[model samples]
Target: MAENHEHGKMDITEQEKTFEGFVKASIWVAGVAIGILVFLAIFNS
Candidate 1:
């Protein structure tokens, strides 16, 4: 039997690993989506 070893390398940064960063990102995405929707609604009519 062979023992498995971990690579121990992280693909993501430490700043993006925090809950605060996640919430901030979610809010930013939501705001952008809402702005797009509003623009489409106003221009489509």
Candidate 2:
């Protein structure tokens, strides 16, 4: 029915937003981890 189609669209939109947020967070974490490793190498050397 039309109602089910509308609900499915809403669910898809919500999932997309959640996935985008997760990707952004993962990138930030990776950047921070790399920064820390570089700093450690510099300090140890």
Candidate 3:
């Protein structure tokens, strides 16, 4: 039973790390997309 609890905690920690990584990646992607859009607008205008 204790082993199972420990395993569960490990799983949760891994999941949290994965989620944080995804969030960071998404923010980077969004920033790049916004930068591209702004550049295009300036160039087109």
Global lDDT of each candidate: 0.82, 0.88, 0.87
Q: How far out, in Å, is residue 16 in model 2?
A: 0.3
Q: What is candidate 2's lDDT per residue for 1-45, written digit by digit as tens? A: 765565434547878899999999999999999999999999988
TM-score of each: 0.61, 0.73, 0.73
How does model 1 score by TM-score?
0.61
Ten-residue segment with the worst summed lDDT in candidate 2? 2-11
Query: What tens-digit string does per-residue lDDT give for candidate 3 at 1-45?
Result: 655565434547878899999999999999999999999999987
Q: What ranges in model 2 sit over 4 Å off? A: 1-10
The ten-residue window of minimal lDDT in model 3 covers 2-11
Better of 2 and 3 by lDDT: 2
Q: Lowest-lDDT window of 10 residues in candidate 1? A: 1-10
- Ranked candidates, highest lDDT first: 2, 3, 1
